[model samples]
Target: MKRSVLLLLGILLIVLGVVSIGALKREIRISTNVTVSKSEATSFRVLSSAEQISSWMEGITLQETLVEHPENVGSRYRLTQVDGSEWEATVLDLEDNRRIVMLLTDPRAEIHIEVELFPSPEGTRVQIDTITRGSTVFYRTLMPFAKRSILKSQMRINEHWKRLIETSIESLVGEWSGTDASGSEQLFEFHFDGTADWKVSSSAGEFQLKNLLYRRNTLSQPQQLDLTGFQKGPLAGMTLFGIVDLSRQDTLIYDAAAGKPDDASARPETFSESATVYIRIR
Candidate 1:
């Protein structure tokens, strides 16, 4: 009887161990596909290296390279956030433009993220899989809640990539020209350096433009073109801001307006009644 009781106790302990281990680990997967070529989609993922994560992630301010690798795998990076928190990540696997896997190590837990790309009928399909593990009991209990947040973060990152692939900077470069409602000839020259020049020929005489800057806003649907400038000459230092709806088509449209200034500057107080359409010249 005593021997049988001891054997039973040992079996119970083994069962408990397996259950505890299972409770400490969790996995989540999400996928999204966009109307972009596989090459474009894959390029976006490759460029999102540890060093360039801050460009897409809102709170990340800096990323430091801890280890360098020729094929990207085995490379380790440290990322610092705006709130002074930091996390360490390592590249676990990389298969050229096909897939990338990263291991993110935080103070509370560790997560393994895998991103895979495949060609699709529409364009490219991207799938993200995340596995989270925690050693402590407290963290294990919070895994359910943590999983929700992790999924949201993953979706946000994927959306950023989709927007970037849709409105790639390369496609926006070159000269674009159009005419306004009043038959004014408008010319915009977008340079590779992110600077643009605007020339408007109207009955009111050509308005000199300065401080032209163009940026693509990835957070919005259909994406957005953010144009900033200043009217030169007597209206020097006057602010010009325009939010243009960006479409992947050949034509882009927007309404340019002069922002109100506290200082004295002879600038237009209101924007044009109709939107101006610009067709790609090159």
Candidate 2:
């Protein structure tokens, strides 16, 4: 049987997603939470609904291959990414606006991947936690070494969604609110036509709200994003020497410890942590 490169790649993507354990209970849980310029509820609403996941994970190519685009309990799908990596994932659990658990079962790469979306005062936080319990001692020991580096890279890849959305906002698509969940007023008439707001400063350097704008164009294509209102504040003038590519996904927030670049006078000078928000804001 002839196999297309995409088909074979899709098969391997899913295989790499799993890190097997013979008696390890078939479970591996690792998570990374990231904040975007959206809501916990809204972020969950999108990501938790596995059907919409490909919007943020555009690199995955086989999403449309799922049986029903199933996202509910026990819903399963076989997805292949742009690189031809594929995985067989089953929906293990789902909690609206809180959590979504996905299990990828492949002997070569058996593991559990759970992703959570959080709404913060600063932005929409996303957590991709994973769990991989190896069955045998030899298998378990080698699992981390074989997978952790790749796992970290996966987190950064997903982080790219935040960057993509912020770019849309900075490009001036529309208005967005980055206030954390605590401040969200149900009373306000807010609509996310996929818009965002951004600011520049000395301490944090240049940071946009993490509200990723997701939308469709008039032709109903995947043009789902908008950003606007670029402003500078007190922190805008601070000198920045560190860096974080909010535009790049998969770079986990907790893991990104480098400082950022900031300049009040548009010329490098004094800088401080105040120039950057510890979290990866848009």
Candidate 3:
């Protein structure tokens, strides 16, 4: 009876091993996206900066470069966590201001990540795709759980980046004084509360254009400016897509279309002869 019982226990162990092996997945993939109110160049710069990694990436205590390659391709970085765990990341591909692909590895698993940025109506769209494969059977079985955790981390990182970029918009706050095409005195007041107004003073009289809203993407070439919510005039309730040159803090080179373009490419590429030149008054 003792030998028969031992043989039955051995058979049960074999069955359990087979079941565990069958549960292992070959790989897991995760895709996450975020729309940030910054230019594509700005988003890519933040994402690729090693110095900023710890600020947005959760639990990373430190990061150091192990290998350096020109243009960032083939560069390797070592990331250390608070718990003393470490991971190595190697840049596999890079497209300046466009896309980047990385290979991340640890003892237990390996991950391939691709990040792509595109110009969006909001500012920039960031897309992150990752494929995870385990080096051991134990980790392979845990892929599903790891995928969920990684996705949450990615979303958190994106939010952190968005906040970082928004701070750059503060430079445009305050009032600017300029003149319209007819040489009428023009005043633009940009409030931190996200509301703005265009006030005009002419021999006719002083009147304010109410219900105006303004947004800026400072990192874009020629810098992007959008004005919406015009309460009166021909552009009432329409967005006027515009560009500004802020290279000089004391002056602003501002140009906007009289009306929204059917396509973004049709927007102004350079300051026109009639572009309004504004001097910072506050």
Question: Quick one: best lDDT, which candidate?
Answer: 3
Model 2 is weakest, by summed lDDT over 10 consecutive residues, at 250-259
Write down the RMSD of candidate 3 (Cα, Å). 14.1
Higher-lDDT candidate of 2 and 3: 3
- Which is the leading candidate under TM-score? 3
Candidate 1 residue spans exceeding 4 A from truth: 1-50, 55-58, 168-282
Error of 2 at 260 (Å): 58
Per residue, candidate 3 scores C-alpha lDDT tens digits across 1-282 of 999999999998876665475365657888888887765545665666655545434688889889986456787889888999888888788665578788888898888888898777787788888888887777776765676787888788778877875554334555689996878889987754357888889998888886577778877888999888876778775678899986653477788885653445545988898899988665
Say what the RMSD of model 1 is.
11.9
* Candidate 2 lDDT tens digits, 1-282: 357888899888765554343233344445566677754544554555555545433356767535443336676677677777766677788765567776765445655767776666776668777676655555664654555665676677577756654444122122222322233211111132333234323332444433322222222121222222223443332222222222323111111111223322332233333332223222
The lDDT-based order of candidates, best leading, equals 3, 1, 2
What is candidate 1's lDDT per residue for 1-282, written digit by digit as tens?
A: 999999999998876665565475543344443346534323434444554544434467788888887556788888787998877878787654466677777686777777776656665576666777765666765665566776677677777767666545324555678899999999987654467787889998886464487776556443445555555564355544454653544466666555455522322223456878888654
Clashing pairs in 1: none
The clash count for each model shown is: 0, 80, 0
* Model 2: residue 58 alpha-carbon error in angstroms: 9.7
